[model samples]
Target: MTAKVENRDFTADLNNKSSKAFQDFEREFKQQMAELYQSITSYRGVEIHSLRNGSVIVNYTVLLEVPATATANSTVQGISAELVTIVNSYLNCCQSNPACGLCFNASFTEVTSAKADSVDEDLCDGQVPEGFEDYYSPALTALGVLCVTVCDKRAASPYRCVHGTCSVERSGPRCECSERAAFWYLDGSCASRLSKLGVAVGVPVAALAVAAAAFAAFLLRARRQNLEYR
Candidate 1:
């Protein structure tokens, strides 16, 4: 999760160059790092460090604190595997696309693998594949948001229900009810049809009560009139 950029000589006159170039580089670098940070943080959650020697290091440390209920040991392994897939995918895209403007092609080669459970471990271990920068720069920038999305979804670990709905497996995969059905939560389960049935029965019973009360009142008024006539 860590990326290091060594000092590149923009020109011989590091001090004389228009402070503008340095400023621009700094701005762009920070922006890129921010994007990377956002992507990883959404997945494993992370800590970032920038060294004065022109090195940027990212640590995926948040996985350690995941609640036991939210994610188990198997889920952690799955998350780690998925992160490696995403990072490799980003690296591949950057290596293939030259116009991405990500200058550190060499750095892509250094990121080899990632471990979500261990904060101190180097995910890539400075062994990125060849041509990773050219393919991964634009890919990483464009799909960085997706990395977070996929990670979040995976953390939830929803599955396609048999009925074509999305269901999350807490204890086990359970169906997500369609909104078209009358929905209710009962006894740790969702009951979808009860609301409609309840309404159907309640409306008729209410009408019967009103009609019976009106009939009794009418009968009482008729008897009182006959007594008055007598």
Candidate 2:
């Protein structure tokens, strides 16, 4: 629908995470746009930077040239909104693992002139982090990027769970502990929850055992002395 031109610039202070995320955003954005709108062209690259609040900002420009024969929503604002929604959803999904404290905002500009800067590095080398597929699929599906299928329902105001299994419902994903689940599921993995629980429970039991053994020894010694005296 629209001619797409992709371009990006990153300052020197960008970290590995922001760098990787910027690359992923560009690649995913293009694919998502292609799926949602069939007539995009001149795919520009992306610019990534960090904010003082640990938020990552990604800004990009794409030229949308929708053909008269296409069927999807061809307006620039509509495509821009879709792009922002998908990017934000993916960023949210990324936050599920390792608990990255990142907020994302994307702005799209209509490409008006040719730029001299060019970014030609490999942007698609990294793989999606674990535990995000569950979040990623449904979010994109909600927009028009992926085809629809049965999805895990989100919860209604799911409690933020640490070191626990998360329940999927309509509201959002919530975490809970299973019968054998370890403590601190909030950290994503069991980590030391089971061991910590064991230590907590075992220390008291051990102390009681030692106390019982000492009492039994005292009784045995007293009995022996009384018998000898008799």
The CA lDDT of each predicted structure is 0.41, 0.42
lDDT of 1 by residue, 36-67 (tens): 54545344343332222333222223333333
Count: clashes, candidate 1: 23
Model 2 residue 83 lDDT score: 48
In candidate 2, what are the lDDT values of residues 4-91, reduced to their tens digit? 2223224444445447544554555455545533433433433323222223233335454432221333344455655455444433
Quote model 1's TM-score. 0.25
List the lowest-lDDT window of 10 residues for candidate 2.
116-125
Which portions of model 2 show Cα errors greater than 4 Å? 1-12, 15-53, 68-74, 91-230
Clash counts for the predictions, in order: 23, 38
Model 1 scores worst on lDDT over the 10 consecutive residues at 133-142
